[model samples]
Target: MSSKPSRCVVLFTLLAVAGCTSSPGKDFFTETIDSLHAKTSPLRAGYSGPAAVTSASNAAQRFNGAQYQGTGQFVSSGAPVTKVTGDGSGKFELNLVNAPIADAAKAVLGDALHLNYIVDPRVQGTVTLQTSQPVSQDALVDILQSALAVNAAGITSRGGTYQIVPLSEIMASTPPVSVPSTSPSGPGVKVQVLQLQFIAADEMKTILEPITRQGSVLRVDSTRNIITVAGSDSDLNAIREAVSVFDVDWMRGMSVALHPLKTSKPEAVAAELDSIFGTKEGPGAKLIQFIPNDRLNSVLVITSRPAYLARAATWINKLDRLAETNESQLFVYQIQNRPAKELASVLSSVLGTTVKTEGQSGGSNVSPDQTPIAMQSDGVTPAPLTGPSPSLPQQDNEAPAHATVVADVENNALLIQTTARDYQRIEQILTKVDVLPTQVMLEAVIAEVTLNDDLKYGLRWFFENGGTKVSVTDVAKAAAAATLPGFNWSYATDNIQVTLSALSKITDVNVISAPTIMALNNQKAILQVGDQVPILTQQSQDTGNGSAPIINSVQMKDTGVILTVTPRINNAGRVMLDIQQEVSNVTKTDSSDIDSPTIQQRKIQTRVLVNDGESLALGGLIQQNNSVDRSQVPILGDIPIFGNAFKQKNDTIRRTELIIFIRPHVVRDINEAREVTDEFRGKISLQTPIQKRRGGTKLQQDLKRLAY
Candidate 1:
């Protein structure tokens, strides 16, 4: 490539790092707790409130120990800990052989993570673990504990510090049972309970097909198991009254087998799903692991019948195509692989609902009369399902024609990955999605994409496809009526979903689009009061503040964040000629305050809203959150004021956000701003400078600005 093109490429590369292209900044805890290295900023500010404290209760609630503990130790100091024991009550206890080491660990675990030593369920006496200081092990304290403290993967402990609730107590609490394992029995619509187990929140879905065998079908009273339609009773038989039904053939069975619940209770959650939805005329549903954070609380869905999974897959294929953009800049990002136990976390984030999972493999079934946790196989169990779990089907050379939603419920995840060739289908579905009654004039598109840290090019297209007309009623109706092959009409009306765009466009960032739909799962509070509720996207900002992007480097001349030096390549050496300077600029922000005559002029612009609700003052700069709003603002950057003696000017974008890029040294006092522009991935080049102060031989006595 020519030097000119190369320079453009270089500048563009640098801009990607320093632009307004990232998801909304992360919450304080997520960054602080998940950061790998220990940081010491005593005055670092973040949120602290009842909600934040309560929001953190998830980890403690799941284990349900009297006192949950997380331990940390210095790797350099091998501290020994012992004397672990549990009182009759449920408090954990442990002693650290070294106080300093224990204190260091205490610092790492903090209030949320304190190591609690408890009696192991399987082991008798006590065991002490001296763990290294807690840090991000895949972004979790538990994961960190496992990697450094417990010394195990995929294993959780119910600490030794508290009193143990005997397994015998949990069983004795159940009612007495009489039936012993029978060797042989007479066949009469033979039913057998082989095994049952508790499943996590996500695995709690069942797909049952109504029995089609002409003579094999049985009808029973709705309230009791008394078979009224035995094979012999064709007349006046209670057989036809079967309120609930099932087909062993249509069940695809689960993909990853779930372990039986730790409890011996017989009534597994899986059986209930089938009976409730498997009943005649019942709407079959699946437990989608929408929230993957808390396993204790999860959501259950009355989903489009199992038949709709096929159609949903086809539609997803089309969406995957729309997400495909320039290969030069890919934004597909996967931060962490959550576990099945984290299903509730994913569900919570996606659907904003409470959900949980519970089940086990090869466990006996639970009965209606018995406790919900009862374990007895006397009742005949539904034959386990069989077939291939849902996946992208094989095709020849062309792209796929379907969409598939893959949920790792056990792992608490739902990944929507689709191939190319479904863009037209996606567009068609989007255009027709009038799912709700009152239309929500979308003011923002929150395009979310995962960009490589290299920041060359990540996601570009904001939520341009959003902010268009979408109807909730249509989407729900379609979802309700949707079936396989023609899943088109099914979900377009009801499910009303948007595809994952590598760089999905957010066209409008108006303030009125409140309680906007996210994940097609936001079931409540659709429209916001336009006047009372200001849209985050609609908030205005000035070029002086909002415009200081993460540049390769920049200098302030009483204006916005403009490139102080342009990229140029040396023809002789082919090396990039960059000069990263720390300039001290002192200039008046407003035209009225004409101070510091050394500072020249400030450049600004006013753009009219060509498209309705567009900007006239705040050029291309987003005034609100970047995540929830789409990219509609156009960025027309700045130029330095020459001669360094003129007055600073105003951008005159009326009633919009105003930004002023003060010299770096000027804003070292503002912690937040400093954090915003630290080491913004730009390089500074140096050539030659000579000054002989202490009688030393110097090459030349001047500075040189190289020419391209």
Candidate 2:
């Protein structure tokens, strides 16, 4: 009876202990909390806080070479919705459907519950907006919707496909802008490039960065009318040098309308306009300066007349959807101006579509109106899509044009994605006038927009279509991104390094820098994770033989990169990966040497994960156990007086990080200490008895040292 009772009590005690056990999860949680609080991690991972967005005060913010505040909503096809004039707030939930844009939105936003802010300053007063510390996708969408409601207009997509609200419409309802009574001196060295190729804010930062740091160069106004000149004569020269690289003609000598800022500072717009226009290089004086009286450009008159070509130029914006294919939007400036009849005939003859003379279809309404041919097209009628104005105000007249001047005059611009091959075939039919070119020209602007790892949207002379690519049949082999889990391998034209982002917030990654890793030319990749993605990596070869690299693949690893990738194509792409790590080891003072605590040598290990993309954008960078952090090198711990010096003959490994690229060929880094330690342990085990050697292993030793 006593033995039975004892056994029962022991079993009950064992069960209770197991039920209330605290395992590695809790242990790790406690350890991590204590270590992080104590500044424990040798290489404290770098992280960025959520980005805050607000309207530009006077500095005037520009996006992609266009003046923009935030996204807009589509108004009714032909309905006068309510407009808000005073300071107001509301929401605009972007509805998604079976479309690529929807997929992109999901891929970017994920399931985050809130978004920060999307301020659209349509009113005269300033916009009040800031970023929340814990930003959520819901918050981002909410902010976007709130901006859309500035005008408080009801939006109704024609077919619920896709639509963007017009900034003009929202601003039109805004109260007049109130100018301050007291004005500064002359034009305060502020200028806005009225026209330029699409560029990012970061690029502008790169251009303007040099002057921002100098103490001698003071900004007259942080809001607007920024003047950047050296306080001293000598410093002025240095400022000029720093800005030189950014002054290259991005438009390749195309007419760029530059408006000197209107200010009371030293220089004034009115004072400069006359002298500038008088000069041969001035926008108004130069024949290259493109201005429109009709706010449109006719592509049909390129060879004959090169004047204000806003309407024709507007067509180029239709190619924005092709960015994924590694090609940029097409830009075709006018070389000559031709007769409207001639322009109409050329497009009608080439694209196999009929040209009309009136705004209404199949109508022959004629009037004695002789507005020089303004709009041009490739005879392709765009679908009824809603978006922002495709062309800029190159023309003086802000008045709307009669539809007859355009070939495909629709309310909104319709961008279609296509392939280079099909584009080649279409080019064969058009650029040659009667027939497409048998051989592509060396300088031809062959536009290719990448949609994903596979598939490209391109210009088929005048048609837009989605290009197909090599699909992955085998589901077994795929690449896993730390940022993107559902990532598969897709072949692309150029490597695109995508950091999983939501509402403009990068959710993960230690640090993100432009061109973080290194690879041979043409090394970039793409990845999509979870239900938001259609396929992981899709691949297609570039048809052009321009010799310049067409595709590359670069990917960020989740854990110390250790994944492998196999390109599905033959030889059309390349991939590579790079990693830099810093490691440190600390030791306390020995009893014999009480004066100074001896520190071990800190180690820096750079582990680069190499890949081969073979010219396609679809590839992956895998890291083996050979991982190294950027700061894994030697360092003295933050000591009071005698700190930072590595102890002689002592080794310290602090932290490690990894970077990977996929394409052509890649080199990897492996550590020898692990191997040597294993070898040393094996020798010790052979010498000592089994009981004494017990469970000591090199892997165990390395891990133990890694723990505090």
Candidate 3:
């Protein structure tokens, strides 16, 4: 009895210690031990009563197990409608239908976790869920928030309480947090600050606004080039995608460019474009700056993005067009490769106005009633005038009916005051007219041919048989017969040198003159190869005061080969030549008048067309001479019969022909012109003396160096 009492006292002391350390809530350790005891009671039923009792007593004493089995399940008869029940672990069971979202959130967070919450007035929704298996505490909270999101309401944690608000107002309620990465945090609405790398934040806001949710908020920090967005995860994803596409390296740089205006003034165009696409000085400012250069007629554009620059350029191009109204504008056009006075005259005619040069007596005049002559579709001839008289003066304040052109000789430009439409027409005409004129090189060879019996017809027949296409006009043939058979003939051949070489072998060819000259299109070139002889035209007898006989007048006559040629080159590489050739010489001296001589001349005047690099031959000037020669021995020819033998008499007849060959080459560029010069120089070098040739070579070398 004493031992039993000691054990009881020890056991009572241990129980008091255990009760002192136990938690105030339901005891999980005692409940779990009772559940084990009830489960194993059936397994120990088959043993004898005392043995079982003894085994159970020993187990209870060693392992601290309970003696009696206890119920393993707890049951509640009438629970609250929105009460939360869960196992001791993190798992919980939920079975609620059409429960208020606020109460459901309270049951999960407030009741289960002992946390605080406040629902906004706009947060109104219901949640219905029935789960057979228990969910973890975190999953239950997630489900509650999902149900709230479906009704356009969201919950965010602030301080220690869960604040529930309308989805539209979630961003306003939550404090913004910076997210370095582009991806979103999670679902529902959250405020995230994003720092942009390339694109302007304001521009990105515009791009994201359309795709953003109804309750989302987008703000820009221009100074920092960042964007703060409050949106759902999907909305943030869309913003990220758009930012990725637009905010690239190609869109980052700022560029400046000058765009020259073609018809309109730079100031007017720049002003118009600025009004259309210009923006203020901030993020996404497109037309940062526009500077109009009146001297250059160009607009300078400054922009921060290439795309905006392209857009601005497009608008500028559209606005920089000629104004259709009759508003006068002043424009200066610099004449290139043409005389300003000449260009002004042409433009004046096109504008139906009379423009006078510097020294002229007329003020600038425009016709009020007249319309400018429209150019034909072929761009050459002017259409017939269809309007009223062109002499009508313009009113004081009204725009000039016809454009006025003033030639600025010092600047070599034309100052035109006209309507934009008229100016456009004038500019087109200037573009076509004020250009370098085409040049032609004319080469001529004048030769005198002593005709043999076989060549009595003329040199034309000789050239025709030598594979040359020769044609002569009927008028040329008639003129040839009137003046010792002088005529003009044109022939086409590939090589003029080959023809000349072949002609030299046939007869005694004496080249009187060979000249190569360059002339502008439709200009005249003259070549004279001989002397000017003075003829006594008038004479007076000696005066009564014993003065020598006064010569009243003397005339100069061109003797020998004289040629005047005018070449007109066409676009098809063909030249039309108007040629006047004359070969004149003193045939005899008058015995009665020593000072006067007989002059024989053959002239041919005609026009012929020949291909470029081809030759034109003028011939049919034939002259015949008959002479008698007598020879006798000095002394032995005294006897009558012997005199006949000693004396010799001969009769001779000489026939000669004059031939002129003219070849034209159209020089289109500097290289062709240089080639012609070199060819001419080569010909000169052949005829020059050795010393002169050396000097010419040195001069050519210097010219070559200068050209280079």
What's the CA error at residue 51 for candidate 2, in Å? 99
Candidate 3 accuracy as lDDT? 0.65
What lDDT, from 0 to 1, does candidate 1 have?
0.25
Cα lDDT of model 3 by residue, 230-259, tens digit: 654545556667778878874346688899
Question: Which candidate wins on lDDT?
Answer: 3
Candidate 1 residues 1-708, lDDT tens each? Answer: 234445445444533443433336863333323331232223336735224434333323222111113355336555454433334343334443443323323432332234443322442222233334432322233222222222211112222221122222322222122112431221112221211122211111121113322322223332332331212112112223322222222234422222222111113233333454442335433422111112422112223255533433343333323335211111111213333224323322322222222344443233221111111123433111111223223222332222322334433333322322332222222223312212111112111122222211211111122333432112222322232121121111111122211112221111111111211111121222212211122223456886755332223332212222112222231211111112122433455442222432222221111111111111112122132222222232222444233333333221111111101111112363344334221211344342322111221121011010
RMSD of each: 55.8, 59.0, 21.2
Cα error, residue 688 of model 1, in Å, equals 28
lDDT of 2 by residue, 132-242 (tens): 233334344444334333434211122212122333342233212211222111101111221112333345445655555323333333334233332111223344454
Each prediction's whole-model lDDT (CA): 0.25, 0.28, 0.65
TM-score of every candidate: 0.13, 0.12, 0.40
Pick out the ten consecutive residues of candidate 2 with the lowest summed lDDT.
439-448
Candidate 2's error at 26, in angstroms? 99
lDDT of 3 at 510: 64
Q: In lDDT terms, how accurate is model 2?
A: 0.28
